[model samples]
Target: MGKVTAGLTMSLDGFIAGPNDGPDHPLGEGGMRLFDWYTSGDTDYVVPSGGMTFKISSRAAEMLQEVFSSIGAIVTGRRTFDITNGWGGTHPIGEHVPIFVVTHSVPEGWDYEGTPFTFVTDGVESAVEQARAAAGDKNVAVSAASVIQQCLRAGLLDEVHVDLVPVLLGDGVRMFDHLGREHIELERTRIIEDPDVTHLTFRVVR
Candidate 1:
């Protein structure tokens, strides 16, 4: 089975998103700034106006690329799927990277024109199992903060990588809030420092 891993860029204050995150503001107000490290690279993404490109530092881009290459499938939340407009019908992760969305109810005609999403309503464990099966030997990556927390609490996640951006969002959705009393063991596996952000990886000690 493929390893279940998750990664995200977060502010020092621990928010993965800023306030008022919605369809109009996907990452929330100024939340897009958190991903400056990745977008700084000449990475192309779909925007409302059309395709846009941004450049990040070469070293930061290279490190981000390494993480992107290992993901075979992605698991995210319904809110995330909605906020991104299903990644504008072309997932930011990749066109071929299948997404398994955990939701309470699968929407009618859930599949988009070019992008099809697998909606798992059973629970996070079912979503992870299906994502793992779809991923084959590569890693199944959890992208949304809520889903990442679910994986952590369920003890299904194998690794976590965070690009710790040097900023603070005083209010917003926190990444590690209200996780209950369960303790998850972690071992630092890698660290890469850059002027914009620091990339850190930790193995989930089993």
Candidate 2:
């Protein structure tokens, strides 16, 4: 079995999408700022490794790639999958890792860029089961809206890598929209600041 993780770039105000998110503007106005950490390749966001070039060139991307490399499967909500556009519809996983998208309506066999997309709606847990089974010994990563929340609620999230941007969005699609009354402890926090953004990692303690 592999660890399940929820990783996302968030704003200081605890938002992932800006206030005006929609079909016309999925990211919303000022939304892109939440991920400035990646665009600038700020060293502050880069984790200390053997000091490889890929680590410094694109820390977020490199981190994501490393994370994905260990992934045997992925689960994401419909809306979250849509955010990636039709690109994911045809090729859900960029690295050929299997992806199971939890959605209400399943198309008559969805295929993306030679990659097969399996849509499930039995429930979040069901999706997780299928993903984990398919993943076997590899990690199963869950991304997108409600899905991450559901996992967190189920006490399924083992760890998370957070790249905190240095901005505040007064209103937007927040990351923890429904954390409820439970409080989680932070195991660690690291800062990496560049001209574009600041990276912060917080390990979760249940």
lDDT of each model, Cα atoms only? 0.82, 0.68
Q: Model 2, stretches more than 4 Å misplaced?
A: 42-62, 88-95, 108-114, 189-195
Which regions of candidate 1 deviate over 4 angstroms? 39-54, 112-114
Q: Which candidate is the best by TM-score?
A: 1
Among all windows of ten consecutive residues in candidate 2, which has the lowest summed lDDT? 46-55
Give residue 202's error in model 2 in angstroms: 3.9
Pairs with steric clashes in candidate 2: 44-192, 44-193, 90-112, 90-113, 91-112
Name the TM-score of candidate 2: 0.79
Clashes per prediction?
A: 4, 5
Candidate 1 backbone collisions, by pair: 40-55, 40-56, 41-55, 41-56
Give the per-residue lDDT of model 2 (tens digit) for 21-97.
76666767878777544444434432222222232335555555677568788888887667656443444245456
